[model samples]
Target: MKIFNTPSNSSTISGFLLLGFPCSRKGQILLFVLFSAVYLLTLMGNGSIICAVRWDQRLHTPMYILLANFSFLEIWYVTSTVPNMLANFLSDNKFISFSGCFLQFYFFFSLGCTECFFLAVMAFDRYLAICRPLRYPTIMTRCLCTNLVINCWVTGFLWFLIPIIITSQMTFCGSKIIDHFLCDPGPLLALTCKKSPVTELAFSTLTLVPIMILFLFIMGSYALVLRAVLRVPSAAGRRKAFSTCGSHLAVVSLFYGSVLVMYASPASEHKAAMQKIVTLFYSVVTPLLNPVIYSLRNKDMKKAMQKILGM
Candidate 1:
C-alpha cells in the first residue's frame, strides 16, 4: 500500500511524461492544428451560450439558468486539458512537474464530477418542467437552484478527494510516462510500483454510481415526460414537448454512449488510443456540444443571443 503525502514530501517525482499517440512530425503538426480548431470552437460556442443566458432577463428561466451553468462548466472542462494538450503536440518533450500533474488531475476531476451532477440537476429540472408543469416554479425555486449548485460542487470535491489522496500516497519511482495527455487515473495507476486496486476500485465506484444513478433518473424522468406529452390534446403541444425532451435525450445519449463504449467496456487491445479519444470526448466534445445543443434548440437562448450580439 502506498502512503499518501503532500506533493512536496511525496518523494520528489522528477519528471512527468506522456505516452500519447505515436505519430511523425507531420502528423503531430496536423493534430495540433486540428485540436486547436476544436478548442477554439469549444470556447466560442460555450462562452457565447453562457453570456447569452446571463445577459438577458427574458432568458432567466430555470432551464436557461441550468443551461448557463452547463455552458460555463464546459468552458472550464475543455480549457483544462486542450491547451496543455495542444502545447504537448507541438513539442517532443512532454514533461509536467509533479505538482503540475496533481493540479491538473485535481481540477479536471473536480470539474468533471461537477458536470456529472449538474447534468442530473438539469434532468430533474426538465422533469419538473415537463411532467409537473404547474408545480415547476415552486418546486425548483431560486433557493433550490442555489442549493443544487452547491451540492454539485461539494459532491464532486468530496468524492474526488479520496483518489487525490490515494494518488498523493503513491510513489512514482519507476516510469513517469503517462499514457494520455492529462493525468488521469488510468495511466497514472499503470505507472505506480505499488498495488492500487483499492484506489482504482474506489475511484471507479465513485464515478460510476452517480453517473449510473443519474442516467437512470434521467431515463425514468423522460419516460414520465413522454407519457405526459402523449396525453396533450393538441398536436402542436405534443410537438413542442417532444422538441424540448429530444434535445436533452440526444445529449444524454451522446455523453453516456461514448462513456460506456470508451470507459465502461472491458480493457481493450487499443486501450491507449481508445482512452485518448474517450477522454477527449468526455472532456471536450461533450461539454462543447452541451451548450450548442441546449442553446440552438432553445428559443429563449436564441433571442438572448440576438440581443447580446446586437442584432
Candidate 2:
C-alpha cells in the first residue's frame, strides 16, 4: 500500500491517514469485535457505578459522591477515543480530519488530566476520612465536594489547551499518514514540516510534570492514611481502613503504572507497537477494570450494584 500521498508541496495537509493496526481483513474484524466488546463493557461498568451511587442512599457520603463523578468522567474519557478507534479498525481509508484529530487529542489529554486530578482529590478524601475521622464529615462537606469536582473538570480541560493549540498550529507536511492508531503527540510531531525540538520538549513537560506532581500528592496523602490506619488498635478497624483504600490504590497503580511508562520518556523513543499497546491498556483496559475494582473491594458498593442488578 502507498504510504505517502505524492509528497504534497503544501505546508499543511487537510486530513491524516491513520494507519490503524495494519493487518489482514480477518485481523481487523477480530480486533473490531474485541474492542467493541471492551468498549461496551467499560460503559456498562462505569455507568452501573454511577447509577448505584445515585440510587443508594448509603453511598451518599463524600467518598462515594466523588466516586460517582469519577465514574462519569471515565465514561467520557473512554468515549473520547474508543469509538473513533473502532471505526478505524473497519475502514479501508482510515482518515481523520485535522480538526477532528486535534479535538480528539485535546479531549483525550484533558480527560486524562482530569482523571489525574480526580485521583489525587480522591486520595485526599480518603486521607481525611481515615487519618482525620472527626474532621472528615465537617471538612468534606457536600459543598466542598462539589467545588472540588468542578475544579477538577475546569482545571483539567484548561491545562492542555495552550499546548494543544501550539501543536495544532505547527506546520504539518509530507505523507500525512500517522503510523499508529491515534493522533498522538509523537506521531503528530513526526509529521511536522520542520522538527521543533523546543515544541516537543514543551509538550512533554506539560504532559509529564502535572502527572508527577499529582502522583506525588496522592502518595503523600496515602502515606498519612497508612500511618493512621496502622495506629488503630483493632484489627477490624485496620482492615476496614485498608479495604476502603484498596480499590483506589489498585486503580491508581493501573493508571499511573501504564501512563508513566507511556509518557515518562520522550514519545519519539517509544516503538509504535509499544505505544499502541500501552495506550490501549490505560485508555481502554483501565477504565473497564475501575468499576470492578471498586465494587469488589467495597461491600457497600457491591451491595448497591447487586441492588441495581436486582440480584
Candidate 3:
C-alpha cells in the first residue's frame, strides 16, 4: 500500500543506508570483535574442509568432492555480506555505495542458491550411494560429479539475474534506508517508494520455486534412504546404513530448519534486529558447522585428517 514518490532517475543508482544494529559505541565494538572471531573461525573451518578433500586421495570421491566445493562456496558466500556487516558496525555513515549494494545483493543470493543446488545434488548422491549401491560407483563418476558441480554454480548465478536486475531498477523512494544488515529482498523491496506488485510477484516466484523444488527433492532422497535402510533387515546393516547417512541428514535438517525459520516469518512483522540475528544464525551453519557435521561421523575421515596434517 506504500506509494513510491521520488522524482529521481531510477537508473541513477542512489546508495543505501544499512541501519544494522542500533547499539551504543561499546556494544558496537563488542559486536565487531565477536563477528570477526566468528568470521575467522568460519574461514578456518571451511578452509580445512577444502584442504582435506584435496590432500586426501581417499576422499576424492563424489561425496567429499561435492563437500569441498560446497565449502569453497561458503567461503565466498559468507564473505559476500559479513565483512560489510562488520564494517557497518564500526562506521557512523553505514552507507553502502549503490554498486557495492547491488554487488552484495547479487553474490549473496547467487551463492545461497548455489548452496541449495549443491545440497540437492548431495542428497542425490546419498540416494545413489544407499539405495542403488551396486550402480552408484559407475553412475556417480568423477566426470558426472564435476558436471553437477558446474551446473549448480552456473544455474544458481544465472537464476536471479533477470529478477535482481529488475528489482534493482525499481525506483526506491523516501529515506533509502534498509532496516536489516544485508540487502535482502524483503528489505530492498520495502524501500521502494511505490508498491510494485509485478516485480514483487516475479521476485517471489523466481526465488521460491527452486528452493521449494530442491527441498522436496532432498526430502525424497532422504526418505528413500530411510526406506532402504529399514529394508536392510539385519541390525548391523541398519546401523551401518544409518551411520553412513546420519551426517548428511543432520546437515540438511540444520540448513533447512534455519531457512524455514527465517522465511516463514511474515514480511509485515519483520524486525530488523531479529532478521539480522536470524541471518547470522543461518549463515553461520554453512562455513562453521556443515563440514564439521559431515566429517564428524566418519572414522576414516579422521584418520585421513591426521595423516594429512602430519599429526
Candidate 4:
C-alpha cells in the first residue's frame, strides 16, 4: 500500500533486487549445478530434434517441420530466462537492470505466445491429415505451412504490444524486490505502486484469451480426428491415428497443466516460493521432457534421432 516516489517510467527506477531462492551458499551452489545440467539437457534435447528433422529427408513433412520449429522455439524460450537465473544464483547482489529485465520479460512472453499459436497450428495440421486425408496434400502445402510458421512468430510478438507498454508505464511501490528468479508478469504487476484493474484485465485477456481459444480449437480438432478415426474399420489404422495424436496430447498436458494453475487465477493468493516452483516446472522441466515425449512415442522421430545420433 506504500507508494515509493519512483518515476512512472520503469527506466527511471534503479536496478531491481531479485530475492531469488532463499538458500545458503552451499544450497545455492547445488541449485546452480542442478539448473545448469537441466538447461544443458534441454538445449541438447530440443536441438537434436531440430537437427534430426532438418538433416533427414524423410522428416521434412509439415508435421515434423512444425515440430522442428517448435523445438527451436523451446530452446530460445527457456534461454530467455534460465541463463539470467543461473547468473543470479552466483551473483552476490542479485541485481538486474531495468532494461535487461524488461527485455527478458518481452521475449519470454512473446515466445510463449508464439508457442501457443504453434500448438494450435499443429493440431490443425493433424486434423487436416486425419479428417481430409485425400485433400491434405493440396490443403496443407509447404507454402501454407511456411506462412503459418511466420504468422505464429509475428502475431505473438505483436499481440501484447499495447498491454505490455501500459504495464511498464505504471509506477512502482516501496519494494522493487521480486522474490522469483524471472521477470514474471505476476511479480512485476505486484510491484506496481497502485494496481490498475482495467490494465490488468486487458493484460489478462491478452494472455488468457488466446490460450483458451486455442485450447478449445485444439480440443475440437482432436474431437473431429477421434470421431473419424473411430469410423476406420481397420485396427491398425485406429492404432496409428491414436499414436500420432497421443504424443501431441501428452505435450499439451505437460504445458497447459502448469500454465493454467499458475496464471488462470489470482496471483496474490499464490506464495512466491510456490510461484517459482510452478514456473520452474513448466519452464525447465517441460522443455527437457518435450523432445523425449515427442521422440519416444514416434516411429519417424525415433528413426530420425537414431540417424542423427548415428546409432
How do the predictions measure up, each by TM-score?
A: 0.90, 0.96, 0.93, 0.95
Error of 3 at 110 (Å): 0.4
Model 3 scores a TM of: 0.93
Collision count for each candidate, in order: 1, 0, 2, 0
Superposed Cα deviation of residue 261, candidate 4 (Å): 0.9
Q: How far does residue 222 in candidate 2 sit from its true spot (Å)?
A: 0.7
Q: What is the C-alpha lDDT of each candidate?
A: 0.78, 0.92, 0.83, 0.89
- lDDT tens per residue, model 3, 289-308: 87677667877666766676
Error of 2 at 44 (Å): 0.7
Ranking by TM-score: 2, 4, 3, 1
Using lDDT, give the best candidate's number: 2
RMSD in order of candidates: 3.6, 2.9, 3.3, 3.0
List candidate 4 stretches off by more than 4 Å.
1-12
lDDT (Cα, tens digit) per residue for candidate 2, span 23-124 = 999999999999999999999999999999999999999999999999999999999998998998888989898888899999999999999999999999
- Give every collision pair in model 1: 4-169
For residues 1-311, write the lDDT of model 1, one tens digit per residue. 22333245335456578756668989989989998988888888888888887778877777777777777777888888888988888888998877778878988988877877887888888889888889988999988988898898788778778778777667675567788889877778776666667777776776677778877887888888888898999999998888787777878888888766755644433478778887888887787677677767877777777677778
Ranking by lDDT: 2, 4, 3, 1
